[model samples]
Target chain A: MKIEKEPISGQYGKFKIDGIDYRVYWEEAGQGIPLVCLHTAGSDGRQYRALLNDKKILEKFRVIVFDMPWHGKSSPPENAKVGNYKLSTDFYISQIMSFINGLELVKPVVMGCSIGGRIILHLAINFPDKFRALIGLQSAGHLDPYYDISWLHRQDVHGGEVCGGIAYGLMAPTSPESDKFETMWHYMQGGPGIFKGDLFFYKFDGNIGNEIKKIDNSKCPIYLLTGEYDYSATPEETKSLADTIGIEMIKMKNVGHFPMSENPKEFLKYLHPVLNKIS
Target chain B: MFKSLIDDNEKRSQLSIMAQYLNTSFMISTIENEYLVNIEKGVVKNVEEGPFVMPSYVFKLTAPKDEWLKFLKHTPQPGSHDIIAMLRRKVLKFEGDLHPLMSHLLYFKLLLASLRPVENKNEN
Candidate 1:
């Protein structure tokens, strides 16, 4: 028999945020500057599996990834009513702050993708001194609805498979088959209507373009990285956001929305420079 | 060529469990031609070329031949990447009911992807 184990460690921590209790599931590996990763909507911290296993990244930073409530290993608050999950901006901010404060992480670098990407801008505007820096992958200020999200939660639709199918198109065709399917697999396992709920924040409550003007990157440097192939947050949108904010947007070629998960190797090339500057 | 690709056992198997319930037909209208695809329980029953006065399908996907050419490429560009993307970008238009298409989205997505040439299937 042959077996191997990963260096990553997992645990659950209890926290109270905004009058609600959450048992958040988190995984971590490596040691150095604290790097808190935020996964995309309809997915969880497992998206950072490659980053958690990278030896060089581990040597330079303590990478931590947590599934947001109602995602991955994290369960929705027991006190909450069924089918009432909605991720409001205030609620989302409270959750992240609660988790960070609970763990007593000092000035951790927060890196987020997709909806995670959008929230980091909010974080920067709301709490400039809370982090050392912010990295937004496939981030944008606002996006018009491309399709009717009503299809996502209907009784007739298989929520997980349809979500996965939608996500499949968001990845660059150049990404490896194994990685592309693995990324889609995460969406396929999401709880019903959870993806749509998160989109509420992404598409509606989280439109922070006006509020983001208050972000003084001098206090917390903001790095915007977008993939050319991400239709949800197209490179053009990111570029427009960057232009609005007077910052540069790094356009990653042959990559897409789920950069860290779909093509980690290529993503790292674009990320190393940002990490180095932050360090 | 499209029918043979969809009917291939290996490709049909890749549709997996999603195909079990997808008993529907759809029409694909390119600039120059139209084809009606019929599927039942995950297998392609037939794909018929058309010049008919009236044809029946749950939904119809219409696009220019140039757009289809780009979409069918081994590695499609950003806006042309997927059926959803094409629809979002307005490069592809859909008419008729979308319930069957959206409900069994993965099956349809994989079915269309199977039309790509085998030689470039593995290309990155």
Candidate 2:
């Protein structure tokens, strides 16, 4: 019996833009309109590891996954740790654009979770006509009551364990122990102050409350899908956001913030119908 | 270099965004010594020697003097690092009404960690 399966296969490379070198660790398989997958904050594209290998998803989409700068398997920017590594809305959007243009993927349907999900809303408004459609999983107009965990950045604290505890809290209360452990593993490898940096965007810069009205769905349809167990960006929050923006919001049962990773099989139950509508 | 960096007009403006709601004095007592930081509506007016008392202060953060020294270095290790981490491990302590500290957590964190690069500059 093969206990450990072979890792999926894909091309990986590093490219430079505007004098900055970025390591792009990506996987691609099957053929169709490129379905570019973006991960949530402090998490690399491993969130889509299952989808990259899912035969059905591959049959319909060119599934691809890549780590963002300073994230899993990707080298940190030259000055990532110079000071407090804060992320802003413009900077996060720029990174997404770089990924799309750098790979030269044409009209790919962009799907993201958490911070990844929040950015799609901004993408629809700013670039308007770029992506085929934008999907926000566990997304919100903004995340408030942002817990101040800046104290976690110091030298004496256990970075991995503390961050692990925090990450575990956002998952479904009934999540399998193995699933919860795997999720915590991602946060364990997170660079010091990385989660706090991402929250700067998730909590502060990603607030597009009134700006949601400006998203031209005709240019790129905006869809919001959230998990039933996401306390940070609750299903109600996404539902309220969808009602406000006049877009559609779908809730995935038995999942939390990180849908693709938290419960991909169940998430696909909701995902299949949506992808069918888009495709 | 450390002084100039903190007192820089533009960067202070940017960092002040985190502390815009702070309007009180607080002390960061690094064991052997301490620094009393005074602020008004987010702008840091002054930082002076501790054992220096001010009645109108919000709270105080205390850690072993060397702990702060190690932390202010460009890099820190586990056990006594970030304020939250230190607190979790019981190496760092907080006093006075915690409301101010809790309300402006990111502000106080950045304000204190801002001292890290200063230590680096001093070493160079």
* lDDT of each residue in A98-139, candidate 2, tens digit only: 878888989999998899888888888888778888889988
Q: How do the residues A1-279 of candidate 1 rate in per-residue lDDT, one tens digit apiece?
A: 777888899999898989778899999999999999999988999999999998878988999999999999998898776568889999988988898888899999999999989999999988889999999999999877878898888787889878998899899988998999999999999998899999999999898757767888788999999998999999999998888778999999999899999999999999988988988
The 10-residue segment with the lowest total lDDT in model 2 chain A = A145-154
Docking band of candidate 1? medium
Candidate lDDT values, in order:
0.88, 0.73
In the order shown, the candidates' DockQ scores are: 0.75, 0.02
lDDT (C-alpha) at residue A99 in model 1:
87
Q: Chain B TM-score for each model?
A: 0.86, 0.79
**lDDT against true structure, model 2:** 0.73
Instruction: Give the candidate number with the greatest DockQ.
Output: 1
- Report the C-alpha displacement of residue A40, candidate 2, in angstroms: 1.0
